[model samples]
Each structure stands twice: as structure tokens, then as C-alpha cells.
Target chain A: MTDTTTLSVEELTQIVTRIFSQNGLSALQAEAVAAVIVAGERDACKSHGIYRIEGCLQTVRAGKVAPQAEPELIDDGSALLRVDAKGAFSPAAFAIGAPVLAQRAKDQGIAALAINSCTHFSALWPEVEALTGMGLAALAMCPSYSTVAPAGGTQPLLGTNPLAFGWPRPDHPPYVFDFATSVAARGEIELHRRAGKPIPEGWAIGPDGTPTTDPEDALAGAMLTFGGHKGSAISTMIELLAGAMIGDLTSPEALDYLGTTSLSPHHGELVIAFSPEKFAAGRGGDPFSRAELLFSAILGQGARLPSQRRFSARETSLRSGIRLSAAEMAMLNEFLAAA
Target chain B: MTDTTTLSVEELTQIVTRIFSQNGLSALQAEAVAAVIVAGERDACKSHGIYRIEGCLQTVRAGKVAPQAEPELIDDGSALLRVDAKGAFSPAAFAIGAPVLAQRAKDQGIAALAINSCTHFSALWPEVEALTGMGLAALAMCPSYSTVAPAGGTQPLLGTNPLAFGWPRPDHPPYVFDFATSVAARGEIELHRRAGKPIPEGWAIGPDGTPTTDPEDALAGAMLTFGGHKGSAISTMIELLAGAMIGDLTSPEALDYLGTTSLSPHHGELVIAFSPEKFAAGRGGDPFSRAELLFSAILGQGARLPSQRRFSARETSLRSGIRLSAAEMAMLNEFLAAA
Candidate 1:
């Protein structure tokens, strides 16, 4: 086994930023994107971390992803806005659009935004946490190309569409919950396949609609819905809410015929932000004071935030530095050398 | 075995509405609530249907829930508003709130409202469908009293919270998805027990922290999160977003321990309404034109809307009436007689 190497967070972030800038991204955009990617790696989310760097570069090189493209405001109002991402990276879209939504929500007490034509590339926690930190509750959903099946169906007709929600806590890190509505994410299967381990039964089904332990066959078939019917139902809703509503390519059929140019994993994201202070009834001031009171009461016995695990992971990384296996580091080096 | 009685949709809806009205609900609110409950029953969702009528009436008769209290606007802006249900029945809150959110969204292009202090009742689809019928895309979530455990824990600390999303389709019924974040809803377990069947092994755990096929033990112990760590994380997030953020009772710890006043099942509901016309790039044209184009492309193959099943069920109910098991009708009769 190869010994792992430790890299300071700053060092890792700087390397990723440098590589992105060298390739095609603007300095600010590169830094922002690199920060999230590095954090993912630090939190051991290899699939969304530097492991995705090569894919990002390929998209940029193929001219499908615009490194410097800015998200333009298409429509702006008090309660809602529509943004055209113009093929920008998702993190950049979040950096631009989320604040806009949060500010509107703060001003009007609630706000929502629909982001269309964006590239998918990162974990959702950072963006949600950012909103929560600003004293807003937020929920976000995104639709992607098909990788999951509807309940009882063999075909891959739905994306492993993800939904995330975040809320500001009185005396702790913002509570964050982010998850893809799939039995097993494609990345997990890939990891298991690489590690040469058998997948658990019921995680996926083969082409013939039978459960399989072999990762290869599972990939060849389709990932099952998380809780059979309930998950399939939610995934289907994500398709409609994020895909059809946001005007992004959703089902496999729409993606298959998107013309001669290769479709760049186009995704549509929806974000909502709400201010709690606006809802406090009969409270003189400090609407969140009641919130704090209620939260303390409900968490009476023992309760923790949803993102506590990831946050703890982040703390450990901050203290001891992030460690990467030789194989992962080599992957990063290969991408950087190419850049 | 008793044969199931097939009653027309109108007949069943009338029966349900009469029962609610007799139990002190306003005519409109009773009808609205009755439609949702009866539809849930027709679709075999016994948990959300008339099964809870007695519990709902118990709260209403105890003066915890208002029979005709309307949602009052707490704060209002172009895109956002805070509404206090004032201890009203939830359907009344939805009826009063959904339209306001929809109209504001239509007028300003987007709108959102936080609904708090409402009793728990009904499926979310009817409200979502109401929004979609007005030609807006909508998403809603409600956090309930704790009924689920976090992953790796033995305590029940989160509600089997349900999230719903809806979108309008071109020439098709709006696609709607509604589901709880639990492995199995308590209703399903109860159904299995009533049928004298065994529960699925992985779906729940007994009080001893071991998997049990006994529904009684599962109910006494804990409901598993839908997708292990991911689902647990989501349940936590819902508690924050819908509970703490909306200033309602969330975890068990946050509840009032003061008086013997029966605890009000306060649910915080968040609704987001989006107008496609506001976002379409076309000038002074049909707002849904672009969404229509994309949806057509998506439905090119064998893809179907998420609400197709329910819509079909609705159609069947309309054409041939609704079929109710003898036991269920007996339960409804019992509720009516008690009222």
C-alpha cells in the first residue's frame, strides 16, 4: 500500500486554483471553484473532488463549458428571478445567483431563483451553507442527465437528481442536508468497482430487472430508487421541478436528440431562501429569538445538525491537513501536468 | 372475506366532506380537505386519508385547531410573505396561502410564503396541483413531529417529513411527486399489520436495535431513514428548514413541556411558485412555449409524468367510482358516528 501524503488546505486549494487558471478559468472563478473542490476532497468526497478535475478540463477543452462565462440575469423581481448561466460552472452560478436570492429574500422575506443552462461539478453543501450563514433557510434541487430508473422500470429515465436544504442554527454550524435521490450514486458504484468489492443487493438491478452484486452489471443496468417507490416518486418530481420547470434537458429522450454537438451535462438548479424573523408572531423584536427558543426546546434531549458529519470531517482536515492516497494524488498530478 | 364496495368519486367525496363539516370544519375547507383525503384513500394511501380524521378532530375539538381561521399575512413584499395560520386547519391554510403565493408569482414572476402554526392533515399533491393548474411550477415541504431516527442512532428524533414538487406539462396533467424521507411510512407498517403480513426486513428496526419483522416493535422502536446516511441527513435538514426555520416545534426537545394542553401538531409549510412566462427568452410570446418544446423532447420516448399514476387513478375513480375496503368504510363510519 502506498503511504498517503498530507497537504495543507491552502496548498491544495492553491494548486487546484493554479491549474484551473492555467487552463481557461478566470482567476476569481478558478479560486472559488477550487476552494469547493478541495473542500470536497478534504471531506473525502473523492468523486466530486479532484477526481472530477479531469472531466471539468475535458468539458472546457471541448468548448462545451465556458470558464469565464458569467451568469446573466434574465428576470429579476422581489420574490423570484431567472438566470441564464451561459454555460458557466455551477459553483460560479451559485456564487452569483445565491446571494441575489438571499438578498431578495432578506428584503422581501422570501425569494427563489431558477438557474438554467449550467454545468454540474460540485457538492451542494457549500452553497447551501452560505445561504444559511446569512440567516436564511434554503432548499435547492438540480436535474441531470439520466442515470437512474423509475420504480419498477428497467430503463434509465431519470437522473440521480439531488435535493438539498439548509437552515441557520442559533449556536452551531448551519444545518445542511444534501443528497441525491438514488439507491447508490454512480460514483459509489465506481469506487466499489475500482476497489473490486461486491455491491450490496437491492442497490441496483441488472438489465433483466434482477438485483445484482456485481458493480459492472449494476452499471450496465440501472440504479434502483432509494426506498423503492417513495424514492422513485421523489426522483420523478425532481425531474419535473428542476428539469421541465427550469427549461433544462431532463429525460433520456430529450438528451439523446440535442443535435450534433455533444450536450455538456446541462443541469438546471432551483434555490429558495426564507427569513424566519418575518414569521415571528407577537414577538416585539428578534424574530429569531423565538426560533432560538423553539429550537432549544425541540432539541431538548440530544440532536445535531445534518451537516455535522461533514463539518467534523472538515475540522479534522483543518487540524491535521487533508490526506490523499497515492492514486488520487497521481490523478491530480496528471491533470495538472496536462494543464 | 367482505367484498370491496365501489362508490362513485362524487359519492365518496360527499361522504367525506359531510363528515368533516359535521365535525366543525367550514364547508369549503371541509370539501378541500375531503378531496385530498378521499383521493389518498382511492390511491390506496390509507395513512394520509380518512384514517387520521379522528386524530384531527381530537385536536380541533380541544380548541387547538380553529375551524375557520384564515391565514393572515404577517409580512408582505413583491416576492415573499410570511403567513400565520393562527392555529387553523392545514387545508384552510393551504387554500388561503397557495393562491396568494400563486397570484403573487404570476404578478411579479415569483412568490413564496412560509406557513406556520397549522395542524397536520392531508396529502400535499392537491395543493401542488392547485398551483400547477394556475400555470405555475410549485414545490412544498412540511416538517412534522419526530417519527424517525438519525442513522446509527436508536432514538426517534425526526418526523417522517414529506416533500412535494410539481410542474405543469404540455397537454398532460401536471407531474407531481410527494414522498416522506422514511424507509416506510408508519401507515404502511400499520397496513402490513392489519393484513397480517410481515414487514420488510431492512425497512425498520425494533426497540432492541435489531431488525424485526414485527410492525408493533418497529413502531415502538424507530423508523429507518430512507437511504441510510443520506436519508438521515435529509431528515435532519428538513427539521431545520421546515421546523426551526419556520419557528415551529421541531425535535422532541424543542416542544413545550408546560401544561397538559394537548400538544398542537404544528407543521411549517413552505411553498414556492414560479411562472415560466417570466423566464422564457421569447419576446411577448407564450411563456410556456419553451417549456413545451423541451417537454415534448423529453417525452419523445416512453417517458411519463410523475403524477400519471394518480391522474389515472383519478380518472378511474371518476369513471367507475372509487373502491373502498369494507374495513376502511367501517372506520370512516366509526369516525362519523363518534363526531
Candidate 2:
């Protein structure tokens, strides 16, 4: 009855689930993938939601990612766990490991897990947010291809390496945030460039190793780390923490490794979970109360806490339904027809 | 002889030790305090070094901090340990808890120690850097009196909130970094205000609730968080992790509690240590090999790590003898003359 095909959350999830299964993913794998896609779509994430369906299917078709691969828990000892994702999508691996990681942290006070052989291209909030319900704090990061330059560097030598952290709240939503150490997201600069708008100073540099306000020049050159040298240092730490510390490939190494694959350029990730209750000690046994003080302070200042926008956005989309463009719907339907 | 005195590290330490001891601190506490002060002075840290002597002396003089106090560890049975500093200098607190934190981390794979009821007015890096030598990755953070405002907020409601991280390297010096989430150091802003200098855009807001480039107005209002909202979010996390999570006072509360004290406002801190070997699970069991890969790549890029400047500065100062200004020398000698 409507000119736009406004689909409810259930409808969107069903469609995404069916498409993945039609393309050879097992029912469980399809469901895992759909949960991530629906999360993105529900939150109005343009790049990571339905827009990524074609690329994801093509990556699976290209044999870069396995449609029905089993992510194995390679080993578990001490406070660290290692998982081999078996070339599956990271969300697929996350669905399998999130519960175990949370449980392990509850038992051990603090626990860490690193997922390898993964291809991740989604907002990391959901993964961390999941752990918060059980009162576990989580920290996750991953390396992709390098697109950012180091501070004072002439070439692009780092990725927009994402870092996410989550803390639990007893009565309300948990505090969760994920951010790239870069000055601006790559697409954000590209949007400014498209609109013929100037970018913020210190956001990027031209090929001549100078900062540029022209997003186009910056894009052709390299993005700068946020907060000058501090952000670059943090980026380098992420490369080491997510790459070398976890026994995976660093950014440059990942690019080289992926060059040989028919798969996409993205690869590998590291995830860590912490149990607040298990690590709880100093606070006369009431860490959660102190956490709420933060929420009260930020909201009192009329500023939003990190990830607050996404929660509201998701609620709206779920209530009003998700709207997909005509071209995207056609492309998704085509996948089913071909299968 | 020159008006500016050039003292060796040992001479400086002895002078600082004597001053603290004369000021009524126990001999052991004096030596511990002297080590941190000398480290800052040797590194040419203008604020944390000699400039802090008066405030330190006054806090002791006012009987706000106990000079002969002992910091005790209250065990939590888990990997986390809690140290009650009993109102000593943070360095004195560190001198006792650092070894215990490292040992607990090594024994449990990952351990955290929260130091409570301390007055920290020094650089946090040395605390984190000390853990690196033991092959444990360290993260230390604390909330001080509020001076920086949250992004989009009109008032200064958050502390500069320093967070530091240290990663161990096998060959080169450890990768260590400490950053305050604020746009600029408060002392730096105060200097600009004194000199009638203008602050940079995006650095602060005027008291009239507008973005301001005037240092005086910004100081009267609030210093902006670095990297905007991302920095503010990180600052909030530190306040929770170091303050409420550990059952200590937040910045505003610390200020309220210190309203009657002659002590310059700084209170409490949280320190954590992680054993890298305990968390190693990938890299064919050769964790160091993967860690090296990070060093190899970043060095190959020509950009320097965060601590490089401080290291070079410290070495030169140590070799050439630390030169203290006439005013500073007079202040140090006054502690002796007064005693």
C-alpha cells in the first residue's frame, strides 16, 4: 500500500537470513550473520547494513570467506583465549565466542580473547555491548588495510584501527563506545569532498607531507591520526595489540597476505572481555553505583554518552520500520534468484 | 660558578630527599618522593618537577598528607589488588604497590591494582614505565580536580584525566605513552593567559558559552576535550574506572573534600599491570617474535614513538647535569633554611 517498501525488523532479518542461507551458509551461520546485519540496518548504518550484502556475498563467492566454516576455539588457558575464525566473517565468530569470553571473564576476574583469520567490516559496538549485560567490561580492536599515515610520515602506514570499550550499568543502558584513532572517518572526509566542503584542519595531509583542508587531496594522500602524535601512537599500539600481540599479521602484513587471496582486503581482529563483578574489590562492593555517577554527570551537562545515539536510532527504526532503496532491494533479490 | 646550578641526578635526588625529610616526611618516604621529583626534573618537566615543590611542602605543612604514613594492600582474592595510600604522594604509593602489582599480574596472567585515597601530582608515565621492565604491559590512570569540560558542554565538569599505557619491547626501550584527554594542559593555558596570548580554536570555550580563542576567557570557562566527544567519553571512562569503580571520590567530590586543605587539589589513582607472556596464545607460541614485528614496521616508517622525546631529553639532562633556575634553587634551599 505504501510507495516505499517499509519493512519491520523481523522482515529485514528474515530477508537477510534467507539470502545468506540461499548462498550456501548453514542455518546457524546465516542467523549469526543476519543478527549483525540487522543490528546495523536497525541503527541506520548505511555502509555496514544492507548496503554490504552484495559485497559480502561476492567475498564468499570469491572464496575469500567461507559461508559455512566452523570457528574453533583453538586453546584456552590462563586468562587469555585464542580462537581461529577459519576465514569466516567476524560477526559469525563473535556470536560463537561472545558468551564463552564473558563466562571466562566471570570466572577469572579478567579475561582476554584474540580472534584470528577473520574478515571484519562492522561496527564493533554490538560485540562489546553484548558482554555488558552480564556486568562484564569488554575491549576489542582489529587491524585492516593501512589507509592512514603515521604522524610526520610521508606515506600511508596505518589503518583506521578501531577500538571499542564497554562498561555495565545496573539500571539503565551500559556505557559502550567504539572509535578509530584517526582524526575523521574515511567516509566522512569523502562526504565533505563530494559536497565541495572543506575538512577540518589536522584531519588529513597531502602527498607533500603537509596538512590539507581539501578532502580530495587528503583522500588521495593519507588521513591524519586524531589529536596529532597522541592518536598516531595509539594507532600504532592497536596495530601491535591487535596484530603482533595476538599472533596475527600487522596491517602491512595483512595487505600482503590478502593480496594472494581472492578475498577482500580486510583481515584479523582481537577481542577482550573483563568481568566487573569478578574484578570488583575496592568499592565497599558497589562498583555499579559509581558507574551511574558517570551517566548522571554527562547527561546533566547536556552531552550524550558514547553509543547513546545508536540506541535511540535503533529504537526509532524498529518502530517505524527500515526503508531500503530500490536498487539495494533489487540487488539482494538478485542474489536469491541466482542461487 | 653560574647563577643557575647544574646538579647531577644523584645530587638532585639527595637535595630533594633532604628537603622532604626536613619537611617531616620519614626517611624512606623522602627517598621515594625524591626519586619521582628527580625523574621529572631530569626530564625537564617544567610543571611536575621543581614547580611542584611549594605545593608539596604546603600539603605536608598543613598536615593534609601524612609524611610517615604507610600504604597497605587489602587483598581482593582475585587478580585485582587494592592499595590504600593513606594520603601519601602517588610516587610513594607506587614505590610500595608497583612490585606487588607486577607479581600479582605475573601469577594470575592479568592483574589490576587500584590505589585509593592518594594525592597524585606527578606524571603517571614513570608508574607505567616501571611495570614494563618486568615484561608486564601496564596501564595507569587517575582523575584529578576538574578543569576540562565535556564536548558540547558549557562548564568544566571533568578532570584533565590522565591515562597512560606501556608495552614491553625486547630490544629497544619500552613503548610508553601518557596523554591527558583535554585539549591542552591547564598550566599551559594559564601561561598563555598570563602572557596575554590567544588560545587556538577548538581548544576551549569562553564563559559566555561560545567557542573562544582567548586563553583568559577559556580558562574562566572550560578547556575543551581533545578530539572532541571521543576524548570526553574516554575521560568519563577513566573517572569511572579510577574513581567510582574503586570506591573513591570523583573530581568534584575530591574538590569538595579538599575545600579546607592547603593541599593543591589532586587525589586518588588507579594502576593496572598485565603480563604479556601470560596472555600470549598465537604466533606459533613465539609471542616475542610477533611483538618484534610491530617494532620493525613502525621503525621502518620514520615516525617516532610517544616516549622518544622524553627519553632523549632525560638522557641529555642526566649527561649534562640538570640545570635548575636561580628561583628554583632558592626555593629548594628555603626548605632547608626554614627547617
Best by lDDT: 2
What's the distance in Å from true for residue B166, model 2?
1.3
> Mind giving the per-residue lDDT tens digits that candidate 2 earns over A288-307?
87667667877887878877
* Candidate 1 per-residue lDDT over residues A56-157, each given as its tens digit: 787788787778987777544546666777888877777777777877877766777777777776777777788988888787887766667777676667
| Runs of candidate 2 exceeding 4 Å displacement | A26-28, A74-77, A192-200, A213-216, A260-267, A278-282, B260-266, B285-301
Give the CA lDDT, 0 to 100, for residue B154 in model 2.
75
Off-target runs (Cα >4 Å) in candidate 1 are A1-7, A251-264, A279-306, A323-339, B1-23, B38-53, B68-71, B194-197, B251-264, B281-309, B320-339
- Please give the lDDT score at residue B10 for candidate 1: 77
Report candidate 1's interface RMSD in Å. Answer: 4.3
Can you write out model 1's per-residue Cα lDDT over B201-306, one digit (the tens) per residue? Answer: 8777788767789988887777888877777776666665566556665655333321222343666677777776664434333535544654453355345545
